[model samples]
Target: MNDRGNASARLIAPLATLATVLLSIAGAAPLRAQGGAPPFDVPAWAFPTAPPPRPGTVPVVPDSVTRHTVPNSTRHYTRKQVGNAFDIPDWFPRQHPPMPAPVQYGVRPEGRACGFCHLPDGQGRPENGTLAGLPVEYTVRQLRAMREGTRGSANPAASPNPMIAVARGFSDDEVRIAARYYARLQLTRRNIVREVAQVPTTRVAGLLYALDGTGREPIDGRLLEVPESIERHDLRDPWVRYTTYVPTGSLTRGRRLATQGPAGPTTSCGACHGPQLLGTGDVPPIAGRAPSNILRQLINFRTRARRDSTAASMYPVVDSLTIHDMVALAAYVGSLPPSRTPRK
Candidate 1:
């Protein structure tokens, strides 16, 4: 074989091995099911977990199709009818990016609306990526990656990564419209990261961490972060914000890694993410994103699950990160207030 073929083989060998291991592990150990058990059961070395729900009444899963409704035109529309939470008051615009029918409704019997998970505001949940404020090129590239099978979740059992399946079904025009709409929206700080010795009781409601009641418990070295109110979040109320709790000093340690790169496996984040770490030319801003998401992305890079050209840039940094190091890095990066422009 030629040198290029050899190089490709080298990369593919380990990834294929890893995939086999993952499939084996998944078959042996299933992730905790929703409601039955905690929803987020990622390897501590790879991803963070939400604190266990406090014992009490089962936390209400926001599943009432009729209850989750919003006004559209002159009548109220159910979540299913709207295809997304776009109609939620105080959150979405009446008509954003003049969404094409494909974006507002599904392409047909199979394709789901883009806004279903991304929301009309484009601020996605921890389970998915935040699309708002991304550069159009960057968004397009990711969609293409999904279509081409280069980008995917490292932990499929933990996160099915619905986008991969969805993207595969999208036409080019649908991809363009969805990308443009999300790109046009602004990226803002909708969440804060806090380190705590103990966290409030939380339950896994679908892909969200929700408070089960008004009580706190030792996190036992685990991290738990979620929106204060699941109801408000479902409404897509922009005023609704999220709070993430981590072990104390994780942020401080993470700041050191981010700003100094103590051991030299990686350089200071400012080198790439800009002085303030908001973002650079094509690099999307990571400052205000969810810590879980950041940690997940880092893990994906390490495992080669996200092997797009841009993700390749992260391999060196993440490969050297220990789980604790990842936790610290995510905590610190997530703590920084989001900035859109470079410092003057």
Candidate 2:
């Protein structure tokens, strides 16, 4: 098995009892704010909120103390060291290949390392795009798209653009270096799709959500994806898997939509991406990626937030879709396995 192996099977929660379709219907409302005269309605749930304010007082940890460690980690770092925004904490460097300058330590002042958000393994979190096993050419194109004005967030008010800043700041050589390194690394499955009527209450932690397990709320048609353990997540564990709680029956409905467009409103995803949704050629794999990440891309394309030539085909596809339709498609797509090849 690959040294990191994937998260254990138990990490993915199974779908609980199904809820009526009525719950999914409730989220059909459009976005309250408009970035432009969007061709399609934007859904608020697709955007992540800003992280909660940090406590004014953080318990001091002296440098004399031994470095802190996470379970099974050989690397150790002090709290101050681990929180460095310019350098990524590669808790398990052996888990993947070596990182380049842009991947490990980005340019000071303006650029942030790709690994800081995409993680060392490139599985990525709900907040950013995944780079693992992506096409080298495609990756470069995306970086160019971000550097130029072709790609951007549909909801800029939700959070500032980290990718855009990095794209604009980094030199072209550094961009190519980061792209090739991550492109060679295989992407493991880290998303666990589950359908449930209720989900544990959660709070925004950084760009993603973390469930508290103490409270519960009705799953009224939105996907709630959070790390299995916030403690492990806080450690920046690359092996951490996320469980996405989607409204009941979203998966089944999504499967039909992906395989067949029903009428002519949407196109079958398999038509462009491979039948497995693992992508083909320049198209990147969608299987087992973050659902929120997927949902946002769909929304962005429809809203013209991403107008690159690559996304041209998706504009019409997402244009005719509703909020619930997008949710189901994201849920079903996230449920698929990213790859079957074992790593070591």
Candidate 3:
């Protein structure tokens, strides 16, 4: 019995030593792999990572988004391609109304009619913005933006020949004539305001109204401010641009969304734009402007069709907004004041 016990102890001693050595090696392996720190000792959130640069690929740095430049002056001439001008056919409208010739200008020259780019009845093509049923002041402000170069042409590569070129050449009187023409034209029933009731109180802008749970006053009666801040971001020389007016209630709704909303994934308007809804740096103004244009732009952003620097900034914000929010916001912005022409 004593001799058997001695043999078992001898065997157990060496085996125990071997097991400890193996355990030591196993424990040390992770530390060695991680350059001295044990695998478990590393921070819970720490990820094993290397610098972004790879052997053959260059590292990429994101560019800062900027507002599009607005032009100061424009050159005009009779376009040679009258047929090529923007044209809207009668079939485009779900319901077409009889449009009288613009009373102020008599008849638009061969290529000078609203339908030229916006199509015959103002169903604008995707390439160009729509102009159907836009308020007179809103249309005027946009024309002025084009004339002054504040609003740039959508196609950058097109060079000197672009939408801005067409707008820049238009005289002030011509702009007014066009504004009046479109303002008088009745909007298609299909284009009638939807989501009017769905608009939330939180989305309405200054001096809350029925839309925002305030006074039940109709929009047509109130004097609204133009969204110069949005224009400022979109235009180059905001000082030189003209202002327009929209319904007070609509502008109020626009202001709420533009100024306040979600954070983190979605940013507030004041975060990128300045306080008071004026744009920061190159960001455009949104306080007072045309609702139709604003709605069109928001739609463009949502669809990823209008991808300029300024629009890109709005991508995150717009993505978070519901369709109802978008409509309410647009209605609000369209009601603001136009750029007050400065006194010379």
Q: In lDDT terms, which candidate is top?
A: 2
The candidate, 1 or 3, that scores higher on TM-score is: 1
Q: Residue 252 in model 2: shift from native, Å?
A: 0.7
Model 1, 300-327: lDDT tens digits are 6666667777876665566556667877
* Model 3 lDDT tens row, 310-335: 34566677665654566567655444
- Arrange candidates, best TM-score first: 2, 1, 3
* Stronger candidate by lDDT (1 vs 3): 1
lDDT of each: 0.63, 0.72, 0.38
Q: Across residues 1-344, which tens digit of lDDT does each residue of candidate 2 receive?
A: 11011112111001101111221232211222122323444444456564445789675564535577877788888766666768878888888888888888988877788888788788777778689988887888887887775676565434235677677778778888888898888877787898999877776666667775577877777777888887677667777778999999999999988888633634888877888887899888888788888988877776666777787778657766877998999999988887768363
Q: Which has the better lDDT: candidate 2, or candidate 3?
A: 2
Q: What is residue 90's positional error in candidate 3, in angstroms?
A: 28
Best by TM-score: 2
For candidate 1, list the clashing residue pairs, or say none.
Answer: none
TM-score of 2: 0.82
Candidate 3 weakest lDDT stretch, 10 residues: 40-49
